[model samples]
Target: MSIQGSALPARPYRAFLFDMDGTLLNSIAAAERVWSTWAERHGLDVAAFLKTIHGARAIDTITRQALPGVDPEKEAQWITEAELDDVDGVVAIPGAVEFLNGLPGDQWALVTSAPKALALRRLQAAGIKPPAVLVTAEDVARGKPDPACYVLGALRLGVPVQDCLIFEDATVGIRAGEAAGADVMVVTSTHLTPMVTAHACIDGYEHIHVQRDSDGLLYLQRLAS
Candidate 1:
């Protein structure tokens, strides 16, 4: 089942850092729902607002979406409330749970733009409890496209940034991992193109496999046959 001539060298990937929203879970629907509701309530275009805020932090999005006379902090609070309470459309991406369960908690962590309360709530709705280190928006001064989240995740995992492998879905997340010096793997859950151009496309767990024991130790299986 090994890839006989793949360009990526076969090596033991020491650590794993994961992006939450579009990467591990299909939360776009939920995100859109909340954002749309807020936008419509605020007399903003839902479509345009979503496009502007995709892959951005809530505070940044709030500032961008702020009405001429509205307070940024007030708008941000509203966004947090709307997003945290809206989970109707949240669901795990294909193979997400399996991939997570197959990974050792000690070797991996979740790095997300969402704050801890929101991230944990979404993970719960998606039915996946986050493991050891969960780096949220509050943990960093800068969001994705800035490597702080990935770097923090690696540090919390007790692994060097160079030894970490990141799984992300957005260009920003991928860039963050790359900036952090981790080997970045992109999943196509939310991507629209064919040539994903990140690290790899895990079509299914059957293709890119993993295994975890009772003690939480993990190992990757051979590539799909």
Candidate 2:
């Protein structure tokens, strides 16, 4: 699918960097459930809490929102436990499995704010193995909107920043990708709004401009009309 905005050149994209929770995996339900439970426990409004922390790191969110009256460390642990316990609804995002399975192992990696333990559990719950090169929270000093994660992911894949394409579902992640000198493609897997998607190369999974072939391999192609 040829996306609108700026007509990106048909360059050879050597690496595809992806965000985990809302990008490759459908873990948002579990996330919301976890957040709601924690919010209710702390007498906070669920919807408002989700809105405030939707695209931020758990540590940052805890420090800013869950701290003061609550122990940030303890609240984060509870959320982790809650999310793992409610992994029943977690699964790969539409076309995600096919997309990952078809890609060359060396050409892609996961860049996520999720810590390694949570990332592992979510990937397992989704029935997919972690990609060869994953930049989890443990791997980064800073989180999304800082560009560190995307930069590390691209470096791990041995690809130039300009040759990478990132798929993200959050505004922070989108900005991270762009800041890392990559093109950003946004997928609305979570509670994203039309206005939030306005500056992104947003598209539905069905409109993804790439495909898998018979050899169980993936390749990028422009969507033709």
lDDT of 2 by residue, 92-184 (tens): 777678667767888789898887788999999988778999888778777788998898888887877777878888778888887988877
TM-score of each: 0.84, 0.84
The 10-residue segment with the lowest total lDDT in model 2:
1-10
Give the per-residue lDDT of model 1 (tens digit) for 13-126: 667788888878878877888788878888987777777666667886777654788786677778788888889878888777877787766888999999889999999999
Highest lDDT scorer: 1
Provide the overall lDDT of each model, using Cα atoms, as 2-decimal numbers. Answer: 0.75, 0.74
Q: Model 2 off-target regions past 4 Å?
A: 1-9, 196-219, 222-225
Best by TM-score: 1
In model 2, what is the error at residue 21, expressed in angstroms? Answer: 1.5
